[model samples]
Target: MPVRNALEALTMRPTRFLLSSWPWRSLAYLTGGALIGITTIFAVLFLLAAGVVLSVLVIGVAGYLATVLSGVAVGRLERWRMRLVDRDELPNPHRHPGAPGLRAWLMCRLREQATWRELGYTMISALMLCWMDAAVVYAAAVVPTMLLFGPVYLYGETSLWIMIPVAACTPVALAVAAYPVTAWAGARAAMARALLAPRSDDSDAKLVELSRSRARLVDAFEVERRRIERDLHDGAQQRLVALSMQLGLARLELADGSPAATQVTAAQQLAKETLAELRELIRGVHPKVLTDRGLAAAVGDVAGHAPVPVDLDLRLTGRLPDAVEVTAYFVVVEALANVAKHSEATRAAVSAGVRGGRLHLDVRDDGRGGADPERGTGLTGLADRVAAVDGTVALSSPPGGPTLLHVEIPCAS
Candidate 1:
């Protein structure tokens, strides 16, 4: 297996590990940590001193604030430097400020748990961990090199036998040093990751925002559908009704059994059919009954039009959220349409109620049940629509019997 980090490199065969670059990377990591830690100590001391000296002035507050925020910069730099020993990327735990000003940014940072965690890590790294890192590097590299040069360092002071043995053991000592260096580096990176990594609450917040965004889009689309439905119902449907009346009157004025009378009669019939089709199209766009009444009435209107016999068992009390109602209504409509087209069932049933702060819906059919969502049926669309409101779809279909589609949408009635 390939080694992806210092800790994983420890699992390799001894010879293979010694030949790899992990030891050098580990050395670099420790060296960088030592340097950063020493610098942080001095920087923090300077800030503290300045804040004390300027305590009587407004600039002292700036110094104090800078000291508090210093960990943010250290955290960012350390996360980047961690790449030497840990190949995985560390996400910034801090969130973007809602406002653009520096004051807003500072307030936001101060209010976050991650900010304090970073500050604590910063202090620990400077006071303890960095010193340990420096010691590890010194013992691993400097001591081994000194022992390897034993002959040169002790040419006349020590016996030839002692020097020879000491120099001969240099390679073994250096190989052993790699283990401690890599181990310490890996441990330090793990500690840093635990302190600076993004929290679970941050992920939850993002998911909530994403859900709200999808709901907003669904609401916008519903509004457009209502607008189009209104246009068809009030504009084109009215014109068609007037044109049908004019054609009827013209047909009465023509000579009996004449071509003009026949043409007018046919035009009147065509206008009437067109008007009926337009009304259905308007309902499909957005049913007015859904707005005027509630989900129960809207669903009843749809179930009444289903080709197969539909049994409704709705038990909703008042009204649900507009999005929930719209989504539930469409789910029933699509399920019945699927029953008519694919289920081949003579009878279907729809039951809905609000339970435990959730709107529950079950559409079942006693059809030859082998419905496949992958068959380009409307089931996928049904699932997508429910998902827009963070709802769930559950389907049960066996090869020889009944099929059931269960949906749940969250709402406050």
Candidate 2:
């Protein structure tokens, strides 16, 4: 069974929850909060003192920067501390640094809304939140513990008989109060996350931001692919050509029937094969024709290289976004590769066009069906990449022949 956190445990029956560790966790959370509150008090005072003293000198800017940095630390600390009662991950709202330098990072953090909100949390936590947490814990826990042991201390007193019965009911009373105690502590942590993390309005914005980041990553990946392709084409390919020519020259220098001449000929054949494989690798990286032309030509070129005969029918009005093109091209490549590797078919067909402002692709093969994405990462990866661009993939395969994979990606021509 999954262990319930404080908030989850609160939803259980009072008797069951009391038997769990939530009450103890609540107490510990409050105790830790109180300690952190005291630490924040000292930290704030130190920052203020340092700021004032440095302002008297000329380098007050450093002290102000340190204050902002302290707010960042407090925000991160609260995120960590919130795990005491919260089970959900709290995403940091701070933007990444645009450049690689301490000044840039500091400026980015200071400019974020989270930084100011964290500073407010630091103040509130120090002034009131921790005290409130401690009060609830004391009322729910410490008082009950004292009451449960009241008769032990009051033994032999005249009121011992009366206190004993009331003391025995402390367990029931504490269990009843444990619900609100757990709830209040959870609410406080939730409030801290609300203040120190990204606002809920930005949840959809996070998706858009994620899409843009993925696009940037794809662009960087394309750039790196082109760089590698250029290196192989210009460096290794040229050397292989040179080696093949030198071997041919050496063969000519020896007699036609000589053993050294035969060995040189075999070496020349090996060099040519290696050169062909290297060229294939370069094309797989990112074809030059794809960059110069578009996705139609790129898909056709890849289909041409497939061992199985492939028919290509791709039509487009014009160029699409680079990210869309790259994603579509790779998806087709992987699909065709899976077809050639797993599909026991003699032929495959690739068709692409745009419909209703969405690029449509269909790769069909006359192979035995039963392709399961759960069995392989190829289809799953393709679907994920397509979804990253607001696209969808549909696979139709049964226990018979002919499997069809259709993909639609939104793009403006």
Candidate 3:
């Protein structure tokens, strides 16, 4: 009963229903069949024109705008048709508004190749619709008429002979065969509409640009590090060594004399100051602890000094490549610094573990959290650092809550 009722409902509105009983329901099939054949031919022609025209224009902005608009138009038409004939709800296309002022908008439009292509598709759709309308009428009329009249003609011609019966059966067979062809046409039209739609090319270009910029920055950082190391080794390191030798000689000379003792004490003080400065400079270049003791030891040194209570769970066992270890250490250091400064949370957690051939680090704090990547230069630098090594960084901090900073770096690389 329900199946029959459903079939009846489908037939009642031929314009909206896709499946229905034979004869009375054939109109919907005829309309869809016509649309399919016409739209296919039109879409191919439009796409070809778009490709050729865009090549000639070569004006990126104008081409882009035209392509986008055309895509939108085609997509809207497809959705409208789907809703009316197929009773399917499709996603609406999103259109982004261009910059203000006519010149700016025009410039943007000219650059876009996709817009022109879309426009080409729209023109094709119009032509296809006209052809489809004609085809549907022809198919609907001829098939049903043949079914009804073929039997009468057969009887008249052969006078109930065996061949008459065979000829009478042909019309029904033809009508039945048309159903599948109609469905196929409807599906093909939907697909063509989707293929001709506009999409953003800027996102892909922007991502590539970002990756290259980050790589350049990382290379610059390495160069600066080497420069600093050379400065410490050649300039300050040599000066400190000379100073230490002078202090030793002064101490030997002043072993008994009071005036000599005072000179010795002053020399010792100067040497101590120089050594401290040299250690600080070396640490800035690259922490010796990181190279010698590994990331775990370096992180431990960071946690010990952090203003807030830091719970560290570092489980990385084997030594990673120098670059990876350095990056991982800094990510934690920066995250912890942020937690201490901003995250008003009383407690923070730092964890580093190697899993699935990748290094995963997480720093979380329970504080009055409102961490913004855009506002903070530290976080931005951290992002660049991670990105330099083809790694990823994620930050989650909402107002009046905890903040979580997650970093992942490939160990093999």
Candidate 4:
């Protein structure tokens, strides 16, 4: 095993572990921690004494405030020192102050959970952790040094045979001491990491901002879709409809069996077909019904159009947020399209309702059920769409029959 850290170094063969620099590094880390811990105890006591002695003055408040904020400095120093025994970098959990000023920065630090956690760790380090570290280093390093020099100091007081044997065992004792020193250092580093690092439950500012940015992007896309749909419906489709009507009148005026009549009739047919295609394209871009009516009506329209017989059980009593409605509507559209194209089943069902401020939707088919999202089904795109609104997707498809796709989207309207 490679010696990435003190803990990993412990897995090496005994000779390799003793020869490596990890033992020395661990000793240095513990020594530094012990020194810092002693300094912290005196500093905190001095601040408290100053605060109490000058309690009548505003200057006294500064002392008490600094005592509370002491952890900010300690946390930064400890993170830097942790590199000696742990190869991994420890991240600073504090967020930068949103505004610039000493007061702003202090307020930000005071508001953070990590700041208080660091304070608690600093107290533990001063009162207990650092003492334990000192004890381990003293036992490991100090005891070996005394044994190695014992023969010279006690030569006349003790028998030569006993002194010689004790001195000879010094090398073995020192080598054995390395394991306990490194082990304790690794454990201390782990504790610092757990206390000072940001976790999933820590309400990280960056994570919250990322989610807000994603929702904004989804809203921007929806707006663009409506713009394109409007342009096609009001611009190109209207022009095509006019062209078809003109061609129809031209055919009527031409001679019954004339070449001009035949050409006009063909042009009219082509124009009508093109207008139909454009209308469908506009619907796919952004359904007018979805914007005018609510999700229930939109879903009912989609169910009526699915090739496979679709039974709709919509229990929605009111409208949902636009993002939630759009996301849920598309999920149903894509799911039913998959059923019509892939599922051999003759019937499918769509159900939706609003409960606990979330919109739940389900699409099911009695097909030759083995739907795999990894196989480039539209399910992957569907999931990405739902996730934009902080929604979830669940699929259950067995090999023999029946496939069910369930979706839940938060609709806090």
Candidate 5:
């Protein structure tokens, strides 16, 4: 019964309607504005005082250190206050890079824009908090009292003006109810703006630079692949073809069955082995199976080879771009390889599906697991490969439990 009521409250239309009304909404907005003003003022003043004390403690040398510390402290405090008032998650504080020497450190600290801005916000917040606290008290208490008492004092009659106090008390009472809600919402918005919003034009510039870098990397990779293909075809392939011809000639000469014929047979066998090795190397460079069969068939081949039992649940119909397919196939192959090599689990499940126009892949193993990114080079390589294609890879493996790898790659429509 209690659960049903709670669920109904979650979907209560009338409650939402009342909250969304103009008068109530306005009161909520005003209250939130007041709380932000108050909090910011308080933060600013506190930072200023702390800065002064630090300056006095270290004098010239300590002043720089103090400023840097003050900035970090202020940023964290503001974020904490935001969480308390607004229930918003904020980004972690940015750390200043450590300099080689004391002078370098001091210079770097002084040069940071965040330090000055945080200090300024702290000073401003202190004054604002004090003023806003007073305003909120007046709005919540004095305004209602005055409205309730004003009419009786002015008219000396409680008949017609009796309703005046009630009318006046209405807004004030609403304001009182709105105070906390306003503070919470405003704090969330301000915190998001301050902590999550890009602080400078450089962030946008960096993104542009990153996109250009990715394009260049892909172009370079294609050029390198062409060069490798040419090398393999002209150098290794030609040598292997000549070797095969030599082996055939040797086999024909070995038909006599003399001691020299036995030597010829050995040479032919060696040549055949060399040719086979060359073919395997070329396949490793870029498998034709991956291109001809698509990601599904390639991944299924990988699953079939796994030492552990693998349940593949793939629903891919058409082909993705060559680059995307190769990347997806390799990601699965590497994940399953890890499962087979590291995960001592009895069974594993691999699933692939398209969701939100992106190819999603998941591999799970029920094994004794403690997979850490820092400990493995295979996972790191896989991560870089996925990132090259603008994909994301996530791994979760707790000690003595199941390990799961999730990957998502954007597909061109």
Candidate 6:
């Protein structure tokens, strides 16, 4: 933290910086850097020697591991030295491995780019970084200390008076030198931040945001479809039904021999047929069964309509989230449709249940089973729809046999 205020002290009156302990803090910070640099040099030298000399003995493996660890060790020391000028904790950008163990940790570190960056920093520190620190300390603090104390060394000689003038200017020079030392510390900390911290969240954050956007779109589409369904059921379907009833009454009122009687009966039949077709369209848009009775009932109802005989066995505790339930229902429907159209199977089975916090659906048909997305079964579109809710669809249909489609969707109760 002392060095964190290093820049603040520099902006003050020159006399204030000289009077304060900032110059001493800068000196200590540089001295620590020199020590770390020396340690890095020796450790690197040792690893190189062991790696080359012990290569035949297979002990080079230990040397290789040590080389990687040394870089990380030096980086940590550099982070700690920031306390001389900085107070903020530097966060490591490396991710935790899914498993925990020494080998796993080593693999995690080795695979990260930061590990190589640290090694590069260590090389620079060992080569000339510490020399620069030591040079600054000598020019700014150490040299001045000796010059200010010269009078003590030459007390009995005429040189003492000459030393007095130099000593008088020593504090000013030292105060000015503190700026570079503090500047270097700031640069070092900035480098650590740049190389060690998370650069940007564009990759993971954008993916997550994209998924959420798709899910929202799906929900909105469902809402619009339901609205359309309601409109048709209440407005168009009801009117058509009333029109059919009026035509029937007209037919009954007309005499059996009247020319209008046959025409009225035909008009009634057409209206009835149109109303039935409209009802089916409304159901296809967004089924009422799904909204009212949940997924289990919805699946059973859908299965009952398939051309192929369907055996439905669905188990559940209660309703799932709207997004998951809707997505899963459509996936099952599409799979069954594909089965009916292509499988030519005499019988199909639908099984569903929730396990491991996910809704699972397994649809199978006993028939000709060479089905794929590339053949225009709509499997690709179905997969994308399921993916909107982070669900998956897998199809397994070998030639000339049974076809099995499995779908899984995450849903929390």
TM-score of every model versus the real structure: 0.86, 0.67, 0.44, 0.79, 0.47, 0.53
TM-score of 5: 0.47
Which candidate gets the maximum lDDT versus the true structure?
1
The model with the greater lDDT, 4 or 5, is 4
Q: On residues 303-367, what C-alpha lDDT tens digit does candidate 5 reach at each position?
A: 77688889999999889877678778778777887888888889999999887889999999999
* Model 6 residue 143 CA deviation in Å: 39
In the range 287-349, model 4's lDDT, one tens digit per residue, is 889999989999998888888999989999988888898899899999998998887888999
What's model 5's lDDT at 398? 93
lDDT of 5 at 330: 75
- lDDT of model 1, residue 374: 98
lDDT of each: 0.91, 0.83, 0.67, 0.89, 0.65, 0.79
The best candidate in terms of TM-score: 1
lDDT of 1 by residue, 221-322 (tens): 999998999889899999999999999888879998998898889899999999999988887888899988999999999999999989999998898898
Indicate whether candidate 2 or candidate 5 has the larger TM-score.
2
In model 4, the clashing pairs are none
Model 5: C-alpha RMSD to truth? 16.8
TM-score of 3: 0.44
Query: Which regions in candidate 1 have their CA more than 4 angstroms from the true location?
Result: 158-169, 232-281, 372-376
* Span of 10 residues, lowest total lDDT, candidate 2: 199-208
Output the lDDT of residue 324, model 6.
81
Candidate 4 Cα misplacement greater than 4 A, ranges = 1-5, 45-59, 88-91, 95-104, 138-170, 197-217, 231-278
**What local lDDT does model 1 show for residue 218?**
92
Instruction: For candidate 2, list the clashing residue pairs, or say none.
Output: none
**Candidate 2 error regions (>4 Å):** 6-200, 384-390
lDDT of 3 by residue, 1-413 (tens): 23222223433444344344433333454465356446655564565566667767664444445444554555556556544334336543342334688777555644655556545555555566546545656765676566656676666566556555666766555555445434434544455446544355645544666777776776678667767877787788778888888877777776566887887778778887888888766765777688688999998988887899999899978798777888888888778878877777798989999899889999999998788877873999999888788999988888987888889998884
Error of 5 at 173 (Å): 57
